[model samples]
Target: MINPALQPLSDYTFARLARMLDGIAPAAGKRPILLSVGEPQIQPPAFAAEAIAAGSHLWNKYPPPKGDAAFLGAVTDWLTTRYGLPAGMLDTERHVTSISGTREALYQLGFLAVPERKNGRQPVILMPNPLYHSYRGAAMLGRAEPVYMNATPENGFLPALDEVAPEILERTALCFLCTPTNPQGRVASLDYLKRAIELAREYDFMLAVDECYAEIYRGVPPAGGLQAAAALGGSLKNIVVLHSLSKRSSGPGLRSGFMAGDPELVGRYAEYIMFGSASTPLPIQHAATALWKDEAHVESNRAHYAENWRIATQVLGNKKGYHEAEAGFFVCMPADDAEALTKQIWREQAVKIVPVGLMAREDAEGVNPGDPYVRIALVYDAETTEEGLRRIAPYF
Candidate 1:
C-alpha cells in the first residue's frame, strides 16, 4: 500500500502537460518544437567525453558517497573562484558531498532536517508557491506541513519574507529558496539571501538554497547563498546550497552535482546517502571534475543563451505583458488564460510551452499566483528558438 501522503502527488507538472495534450496532435508538416522543458539543447564540452573515457577503468569500483578527494577539491576551487569565497573558508571533506544531481540532494534534505515536531507542533516546510515539485514532495513525505509562500508580480516574483507569520516561522523546520527561480527567472538580491539566512538561524531551521541556475544569467552574475554567508562573517551554520552541472555545463545526462554547507548538516547528509541513496559514479564524477575546472565552455553556453534571449526580445518584445527575464533561460509572460493559451499554441502552431499555474499551489485565500502566466524555456538552438518564437508571437 502506498503512503496516503503520496496521493496528492499523483500528477507531476510534465505528467499533467502530457494528459492535457494527450489526444491533440501538433500541426502536420511543421515539426513540433518543445519549449516547455528546461533541458538545454547545447552540446556539452568535448572534454567531458574524454574525461569519462579516461576514467572508465574505475567504473567497476564502488563509489564513495562523499566523493573522492580530486572531485571535491575541484568543486571547492570552483566555488571559491565563482563566489569569491575566502580561502580555507570551506573544508571540503566536512562541508561538501556529491550527489547524483541537485534534485536528489534537494529532496533528501527534508528528511535530514525535518523533525517530528517543532515548537510543540507539526513541523512546517516553507517553499515558494510556484516551487519545484520536489520540495513539496520531500516535505509531505517527511511528515511536515507544506506552507506555500506566494511569489507574484506584486512581490517581484519572489516570496516576501515579512509575510510569513511568526507562528509559522517558529514551527518551520526547512525553508527552500530558489534564486533565478524556476518558471519565473527572477534573481534574489544578496541582501535578501542574507536576511533569509538570518531567519533560519533565528528560527533554528535549515535553509536550503537551490542555486541550480546560478551560472545562467544575463548581465551581473546572481548572488549566491554562500556569498551571502561569507559576507555575513563566514559561518555556514543552518544553511546549505545546491548546485548542478545540468544548467551550468549543459550536461543534464551527467547526473552530477554537489551540496555544500554546515559541517553538521553535511555530515548527516553524507551518512544518510551512504546508507540510503546511490552514489555518483566515478566516471561521471571525473567528467564533472574536469567540467568544473574549465570555464570556457560555460562562457560559450552563456553566450548561446544570451543570443537566444536577444532573438526572443526581437520576436516578442512588443507583445503585451512580455518581459525579458533577469536570469535563467525561461521567458515567463502573463497570459489572459494560461492553460487555454498553452493548448491553443500547441494545437495551432506546434509550439509547446508550460502553463505556470500547474506548478504553483493556491495560497491561504485559495488563489494561485501563477494563474495568469506561462513559462517558455529558451533552451533551444538559435534557429529553433527563433522559429518557435515567431510561431508563438502572433498569438500574443
Candidate 2:
C-alpha cells in the first residue's frame, strides 16, 4: 500500500499548474512564455562541460559513497569563502556528504533525522508556509506531523520564530528554513538564523537551512547558517545546511550539492548514503568541483537575475501590491484570487505563472498564506523575461 501520510498534501506546485491549464490553450499566435517554474534558462559555464568530459574515463566507476575527496574539499573551501567561516572549522572528512541534489538530500534527511516518537508522541516537522514542497513530503513520509509556520506580509514574509509555542518546539524532529526563500524571496538575517540555531539546539531537533538560492543575490550576500554557528561559540550542533549547484552555478542538470554541519549528524547521514543513496556520478563530481571553485560565472548569474528584477520593477513597480523581490529570481504578485489570476494570464497573455497557494497549504486556521499572490519566475534572459512581464503586467 502507498504511504497513508501522503493523503492530505496537495498536488505539487508544477503538477497542479499543469492540470489547471490542461485543456486550455494559450492565446492564439502568442507563443507560450513560461514564467511558472524556477529553472534557469541560461547556459552554465563552458568549463563545467569541459570538466565533465575530461572525467569521461571515470564514467564507468561509481562515485565514492562518502564523496570524491577533491569534490568535498572544493565544497568545503566554497563554504568557508562564501560564509567567512574560520579555516578548518569544517573537516572535509567528518562534516560533509555528497548528494545528487538538495531536493534529494533534504528529503532523505527526514529518514535520518526524524524518530518514530519524540517526548512519547508523534514528532513534528516545522516548515514555513509557502514552502518548498519537499519539506512537507519529508515530514509526511517520516510519519511526523507537519506544522506550518506561516510567513506573511505582516512579518516581512519571514516566519516568526518567536510565536511557535513551546510545546511544538518540544516535539519537533526537523525544521527546514530556506534562505532567499522560494515564491517569496526573503533572506533571513544573521540574528534570525542564530535564533533558529539556538532553538534547534534547545529542542534537540535538526535545523536544515536550505541555501540552494544563497548565491543568487544582489548587493550584500545573504548570511548563511554556518555563519550563525560560527558566531555561536563555533559549534555546529543541530545545524545542517543544504546547498545546491543548481542555483549557485546554474547547473541543475548536473545534479550535485552537499550537506554540511554537525559532525555527528553528518556522520549518520553519510552512513545512510553508503547503502541507500544514489551516489553522485563521478563525472558530475568533477564538474561540481570546478563550479564551486569558480565565482565569475556565479557573479554573472547574479547580474542577469538583477537585470530581470529590474525589468520587473520597471513593468510593475507601482502596480498594486507588488513587492520587488528581496533576492532570488521570483517575485510574488498579490491578487484577490491567485488561481484565477494565473488562468487569466495564461489565457490572455500566453504567459504562465504559478499561484502561490499551490505551493502552500492552509494552516490550522484554514488559511493558506500564499492565497493572495502569484509567483513568477524571472529565470529567463532579461529580454524574454521583460516580454513575459509586460504581457502579464496589466493583470496586476
Q: Which predicted model would earn the best TM-score?
A: 1
Least well predicted 10-residue stretch by lDDT in candidate 1: 3-12
1-396 per-residue lDDT for model 2 (tens digits) = 976667645667787888888988889989899999889899999999999999999989978876799999999999999899998899999999887889988887778899999999999999999998789888867888989999998998889988999999999999999998987888999999999999999999999999998988888899999999999978889999988889878888988999999888788877887787778898889999999899999999999999888899899999988877778899888899888888888988999999999889899999999998889999999889999999998888
Clashing pairs in 1: none
Candidate number of the best lDDT: 1
Q: What is the C-alpha lDDT profile of model 1 across 250-302, one tens digit per residue?
A: 99999999999989988998788778888889999999999999999989999
lDDT of 1: 0.91
| lDDT (Cα atoms) of all candidates against the true structure | 0.91, 0.89
After superposition, candidate 1 runs with Cα above 4 Å error? none
Clashing pairs in 2: none
